[model samples]
Target: MPVAIRLADWDTDRDAIRSIREAVFVQEQQVPVDLEWDDQEETSQHFLAYRETTPVATGRLTQGGKIGRMAVQKSSRGCGIGARLLQAICERAKEQNFQQVHLHAQQHAEGFYLQAGFEVEGDVFYEAGIPHIKMVRSLI
Candidate 1:
């Protein structure tokens, strides 16, 4: 099924976005609650992927040239929901005239961002006890 992706309101869509992230990041991946809900949500531009009004995925782009907090419901994996979320966030970065977009991709998710045109950079590091690598994509 096709998913509808749109810019999310920080206040209005916060709960739905948080629910999806909490499921994938906190519950599934074991990322800590403190680390998952970093106070940046209010500062970043968030996007949500919905299937007939049910929120299925989410991602966010920061004005500081970073993309983070990406998550898709466990039941919605392998259905292109994550890609849709990433694409929406990248489009928003382009609209904001950013020349490049960067994200600290979890090691397991490196291939996903690579397929989306991001190139791995730097050595691996740990964030919230999970290994991560920096990845970047040119929006030009």
Candidate 2:
């Protein structure tokens, strides 16, 4: 399947991106509802990956250079959709002149970001009942 990824607007792509995040983070990973969704959505730049118009992956970059809410559908796991979403957000951050992009990566998914040039920065911490580690990648 040909994958398409693009910057998403909260007004237009909110439902599509929310669906993907809900499935991966809420239903699958058991992330708490309150923690999974936040007010930051309004201010952050989001990216969505689609397979022929069906959203499969998503990520968001905030004004403070924080990348978060990265999720990929179970069916789309192992494909490059997650990477594509990450790259889209990273490129956007770079274009916006961010010096570094950082994220609290789920411990299991840390390797995925590591492969994309993100380095683990600190000891593991818990977020939304899941173990996470802070990771950072320089856009400079």
Candidate 3:
């Protein structure tokens, strides 16, 4: 599959990012509105992945490289979209001089996060009614 990652300021990527987030988090996972939508959005860099000009995945990176709102369209889950989006996120963080990147890993996704070089450093907790754990990766 062909995919390209673009880096843009908040204005350029907001809609695409929100669409994917709503598709995956809201429609698919049922993450509550209060949690799925957050105040941090304005301060994040949204990365939208398009396959042949169609948005297939999206994610966001915060100032300190906190990655969240990572999502792959339902039909695209097993096609490496998430991994590629994550790779883009990490590369963006490195380019921005971030020393570390962190994520709230839904417990079931620990293995996926692990494959991306994230390590769990804390107990599992609840977030938006889903069990999650704090995972971090260092680039420095």
Candidate 4:
């Protein structure tokens, strides 16, 4: 199925965004709720991927050029929805005149971002009990 990607409004799309994140990060991954929700949502540029009418994945690009909170439902993994979401976020960063964009990718998913042109920048560290590494991609 073709996934549709779009810029999401935090006000109207918060529920959909939270559902995906909660399912993946909270329930499945055991990330603390406090660590999952942050003050950045209103200021960040959010992207949502939908398979037909149902949202399957989501991510956000902060005003500071950091991409985070990426989540794709387990049933939807390996279908390329995540890459599509990342591309949309990167394009949005370019539109906002950001020279580069970075993300804290979970260690296991580093290869996914690497294939998308992001470079591993530092040693792996733990966030919310999961290993993560900083990765950056230049857009200029």
- Per-model TM-score, in order, reads 0.96, 0.97, 0.94, 0.98
Q: Which residue ranges in model 4 land beyond 4 Å of their true spot? A: none
Q: Candidate 1 on 5-112: residue-level lDDT in tens?
A: 999999999899889988998998898898888778889898899988899988889879799988888888998889878988988899899999999999999999
Across 1-140, the per-residue lDDT of candidate 3 in tens digits comes to 78877765577767787788888898889987778877888888888888988888888898767998888899888888899889999988998899999999889999999999999988999998999999999988
lDDT of 2 by residue, 47-131 (tens): 8888997888888999899999988899998978888889889989999999999999999898899999999998999998899
> What count of clashes does model 4 give?
0
Answer with 2 or 3, whichever has the higher lDDT: 2
Query: At residue 114, what lDDT does model 1 achieve?
Result: 94
| Candidate 3 positional error at 75, Å | 0.8
* Strongest candidate by lDDT: 4
Tens-digit lDDT track for model 4 on 1-140? 98999999999999999999999999999999999999998999888999999999999999899999999999999988999899999998998899999999999999999999999998999999899999999999
Comparing 2 with 3 on TM-score, the higher-scoring candidate is 2
Please identify model 3 stretches exceeding 4 Å from their true place.
none
Model 2: runs farther than 4 Å from truth? none
Instruction: State in Å the error of residue 66, model 1.
Output: 0.6
Pick by lDDT: 1 or 3, better one: 1
CA lDDT of 120 in candidate 1?
A: 94
lDDT computed for candidate 4: 0.95
